[model samples]
Target: MNAVLIALLALPLLGAALMLAPIGDRQALRLGATVTGGTLLLAVALAAGFDHGDPGRMQAVTDVSWIPALDVRLHLGTDGISLPLLVLTALLTFLCALYSVKKLPAGPGGRAFTGLLLLLETGMLATFAVLDLVLFFLAFEIVLIPMYFLVSRWGSGKKTAAANRFILYTLLGSAVMLLGFLLIGVKAGTFDMVKLADAHGAGLSHTTQLVAALAVLVGLAVKAPAWPLHSWLPDAHTAAPTVGSVLLAGVMLKMGTYGLVRVLLPVVPDGTATFAPYLGAFAAVGIVYGSLACLALARAGAKGDLKRLIAYSSVGHMGFVLLGIASLTPTGLNGALFANIAHGLITGLLFFVVGAVKDRYGTADLDTLSGATGAALYGRAPRIGALLAFAAVASLGLPGLAGFWGELLAMYGAFDPAAGLSRPAFVTYMVLAGLGTLLTAGYLLIVVKRVCMGDPKQPAPVAELPDLQAHEAVSWTPLAALTLLAGLWPALLLGLSDPAVKHLLGGG
Candidate 1:
């Protein structure tokens, strides 16, 4: 098991290193696809071996004293919480690599691009796998360089500025978060996350715990980009390449919320309780704020970019994730965890479809996409248009789809928060979040109608546009299938998470 886990982290890094050699673009793509695919297979094997009956306990652990002087260990493990994310990272990266095979990004060095993506994959997997605070932090920071380069080098307009903003904001957050980790490590006499969470910060003074929690939450929030701090996301998403957008939305953003469940609530329960109300308030505000931003952008007509609009919608979806975490109940946390995966699939597909649209038309501008006066998509490419509409519907939290349960369960969590939280406030948040849901449906429906309905104002061109290509269908079908599968049977994710959440909340 330990060897399997080590291989999971190592394969990608090794592939990345190999890509730096004089490999051809085809070789690099093959290498990347093989490595990521292997990682996914390993992840599936790990899942199969996982002791589902004991989902709450960390399984397949690999612990070794890496730096005794600093009390930092080369500790890695997974439970239901981490396992889902690990698999998600592997699956998305694999799909990205698969996509690249048919459609390599236009650049001088496709090898370098593929290599950086692999490196990013390794970092994300490590972040979810490591069980030590210092190790986790190190893994957490490793992704910055690759992602910054990906955005700056491979992205579209304003890519450099967007990458710089992303790096600056996240780096600052990481610095503060590191200080909190060190504080807890020094005060608690260890940096093992599992141990610290088990202790629940019992050894630290109340003030110390509060301060550390504040710092850590602030840092994580920047990644979560939760309201007021989410300014970087829109620009980054708008500028990033399609694969970058997919990974950013799919797995990277979840690190923050995952930290909340795996690190914050367990290691600083009292502090989490102390800050729950404020977190809920911020999350509620984000929900409405993101929805309004989307609505405003949709109304912007030609000025509105579909990718950017989707980016804003992410903020709203993550707001529900945060709101669920704030509820601090097993149901709420489970919903948050479940929502994390759901968003990954739904948003990843959305980015892919949008990327295809941009590729076909050279622009994702609403007015341009709508043709002179009517929706040009269906007329231009019916299959792509249909896929886009399906993704939009799924994203709008339609029932019997993956998106529905997360939002539904989150609202349920907010309506009846765990003990110690003020019910009236949560109830108020619940009401507001519900309103935000309506706004979400409204904007998404408008987007679909504008982009996928009606005839083109002009006659169809003599050259027929391509529909969903083989690679696009291959890359997108699984996400679509899973969206429906999980929607109809949420237990696929919720069951995996519920026991772990119960354990984290001390129910066991």
Candidate 2:
């Protein structure tokens, strides 16, 4: 069974290799889709075989020595915490592949882009599963290379500059993170995460624990792209292709928060206790700041620009996920996970729609896209327009949608933190985050009102316009349906996450 975990990562890499061997063939795209779907099916197998009754313990453990002297080993497995994220990585990759079937433009190097995407999924899945710090870091950094190529080679709008900036920011943080990981390893005398987390910082002094925690925070913060460190995300997201944007927002961002939860909290419980207040503060600030930024983007779109508006919206949505994590309570962690998955589904759908709009309209300028003329699908493409409207509503955290629970739960967590957290400050934070909901609703509605309501006054030449096709429907419905289902019955995820949350909180 443990071997199944190893196979989850290996299968994708093998599939990527096979598909790339005959890269230029017509079936290459289908092969890539098949392989990615297979990886997802493998994840489903794990979910079914998993003993959900006891979610705290790592199930199906695989351990072997890779570096005897430093005591690193090829340790990989799952707990309830890692399971949802792993499954997310699998589902997103498969849907993204399916989405790309007819959607992505075939540049000269088309096959390579598809291959790198598959490889990237393998890297992300492996990083989540590996239990040794060294193995974890390897898988983590391996993902960066492929994504860099994915964006630099295939992305749009100042691709060279965006990719270089992305590489510079991420590499710097990775170095710092490695230093922090090394400090932990050197001090604790091993790289096995389960053992070290169990040791609880291995008796490090309180001050040392705080410093290590800060180091880990700085490293993951870069990836989380929290308020101050978040400058790189917009350009990278704005310029990247639709597939890159989807995976970046949906799966890659989770890497940082996941690190905070899986590594920082457990290894440096003392430091987490000391720094939780500051974490909450930053999360609250990011929420407000990101909300304002969204309004500004809406303002920019009101002037007629397109991609930048959607890119800015990503910042605001992810703010909820960050704020949820900073709450430091059972409800907060679950809210954060809920937001993580919900945002991935909604925002990924948002990007896909944006991409389709760009493809048909020749520009994404809000004012110009009246949708009444040639692009006017309200009468012609009412279903497409309606679907877009539904996604926008869900994204704004409308009641009975997937996005609602996360923000609501985050507020719940902030209002009443765990025993040791700062109650008064988080209470204030809760009020502010709730206010952010109005701001979220504003921009999303502005998007719908501006783009979907009026008749297409100035036709976007028919040559440029086409409605949503069959394959796109195949890719889109599951995500939208899940978003609605989760919203209606929040228990599906809440029930799954409860035991894991209890374990993380040192028992509920």
Top candidate (lDDT): 1
In model 2, where is the ten-residue run with the lowest total lDDT? 371-380
Please report, in order, the local distance difference test score of every candidate based on alpha carbons.
0.90, 0.79
Q: Cα deviation of 465 in candidate 1 (Å)?
A: 1.9
Clash count, one per candidate = 0, 5
Model 1, 1-508: lDDT tens digits are: 8788999999999989998689788888888888899999999998889888888898889999999899789999999899989998999999999998888766656799899999999999999999999998999999999999999998999999999999999999999999989998999999998888888768988898899899999999999979989999999999999999999999989999998888889888888899999999999999999999999988735479999999999999999999999999887888888889999999999999999888777777887766545556787778888888888989889999999999889989998999999999999998989999999999998888888777655653224568889999999998899889999999878888998898888823
TM-score (C-alpha) between model 1 and the true structure: 0.98
Q: Which runs of model 1 end up more than 4 angstroms from their true locations?
A: 300-302, 456-463
Each model's TM-score, in the order given? 0.98, 0.95
